[model samples]
Target: MYAAVVRSYQESPKFEAIDLPEPSGAHDAVVDVLAAGLHPRVRSQADGSHYASRGELPLVPGIDGVGRLPDGRTVYFAAPDTAFGSMAERTVIDVRLSVPLPEGADPVQIAAAMNPAMSSWVALRRRIAFRPGQSVLVLGATGNSGQMAVRIAKLLGAGRVIGAGRDPERLRALRAIGADETVSLAGDPETAARRVGEAAAEVDVVLDYLWGKPAELAMVPLLKRRSDRSRALTWIQIGSVAGPEAAVPSAALRSANFRLLGSGQGSVTTAGYMAELPALVDAIADGRLSVNAVPVPLADVADVWGTPAGAGQRIVFVPTRGAGA
Candidate 1:
């Protein structure tokens, strides 16, 4: 089997031929790798920027993938904590972690969609109690998860959806997807905050992906406008694309009457994940939710990593020819 292995932290991944081993656990099933999503986290892992403080090395870094099982069943999975080995011809995953793919579903699309969709799903459903007709503000709207968040919020019946991002062109694309309004995240924090507040005078929910000084400043003013004293405004933090640390004013919480929630795959229980999987698939199949993906050969993975094409949409890595659509 040919696998891309990160020999060390902070080093570029190398593609090398390796021997394939059988599954060790009874719960594990070997999957013929069809497509793997190249995400920012994968690059972070390779470059020693993310989860690097933990010091795990010699890792095969990929969190989401779609593949076929020995029984010829197509499946996709959200394998976060476990060792990610999806950048190869074949890999093994726990059966509980795998979800059967719909018939005729594009492997590349499924591979690309699962991670971002799950992130959005988990954030909206588990982290925050998002109710129908509630207004939502999505930060980092051009990002894969951010775009998915906008779509998910609309699908879940958000009364108004506002998208904020630095790119003007991407913001236009965001409106086409689901966002009712788009705001450019330019200028200083105060100026950006004013623009966001003006776009939507009041918002019930905030899906924050960028956590930094700017994000903090922007959120402070927007959150301050929530009027429903009984219903707490939910602010779900899912990503740190801007920076890990944020400078938030403690006083803002007092005025907003908001509940700050942190969400990720880690926050979801196995039972909870199982319960939502069916509805998620139904939404996808019904065309209520859109999944955007870019398919690229595994050989070009390094090049894509070197460039910037791997940033916005889900970049699916097709390990074998004829596997992806």
Candidate 2:
């Protein structure tokens, strides 16, 4: 079968013919991959940078995809056990990692949205002990996960949802999706941080995606402006697309009544994720959650592989269907 073979961490994957692996465990099953998303996790996996890193090279480079069984039942699958991943004509999937999609659900959209969407969904519903009507600030809100955070916070009964990001136009547009206010992170660090701090002062929870300089900027001013001291503020770190290290203020931790924690893989257990998946999928099917996606053919992936999927539209690779067909 043809797959996107990644031989080295420094290189892009090549679409080539490769030997497919047979299932080793009774729970494993092969599925015809219909569509797969080029999520950040997939890229990290390919380069052996993700937390759940699979360094065994000469491997297929996808973490999750929409696939169909021999009986034609469509399912959204994750984490191929063979270490070859989901970017292929066929891949091995553990049955426990697969979820049945809703009728009329767009496979490409589900493929595109699920991973990013899952971060905030699980964080809001499970990672933190959430209370309805609390205020929220979604740091780096222009990203895919950040956008989802704003909407999901509202769906879960947030009173005010503030979105802060580097893009002005995109941040402003977040209002349509339930962001009560938006702050621009485009200026100098101090200025942007001040704006982020101003917006964040009253929020009860923060779903942070960017954690580098931006986080540092926000933290400094946040310490000065914080007002809610009735309860501990929950700051859940979800993504580090901005940068991995933040020169956080010592006073911010010393003075503020807040708890900082990460929300993905290691922090949230497999059982916690599984418990939230059904509700998250239900929200998508019921139209409470929606993903804007464009389908690209697997053959054309070489051209668009490392291209960024901005908040506007995520790209989904259709293995069987031609690009945009």
Best by lDDT: 2
- Write model 1 residue lDDT over 38-70, tens digit each, in one string: 877777766667753345656677876888889
Query: Ten residues in a row with the worst lDDT in model 2?
Result: 316-325
Compared with the true structure, the alpha-carbon lDDT of candidate 1 equals 0.75
Q: What is the C-alpha lDDT of each candidate?
A: 0.75, 0.82
Candidate maximizing TM-score? 2
Query: How many residue pairs of model 1 clash at the backbone?
Result: 0
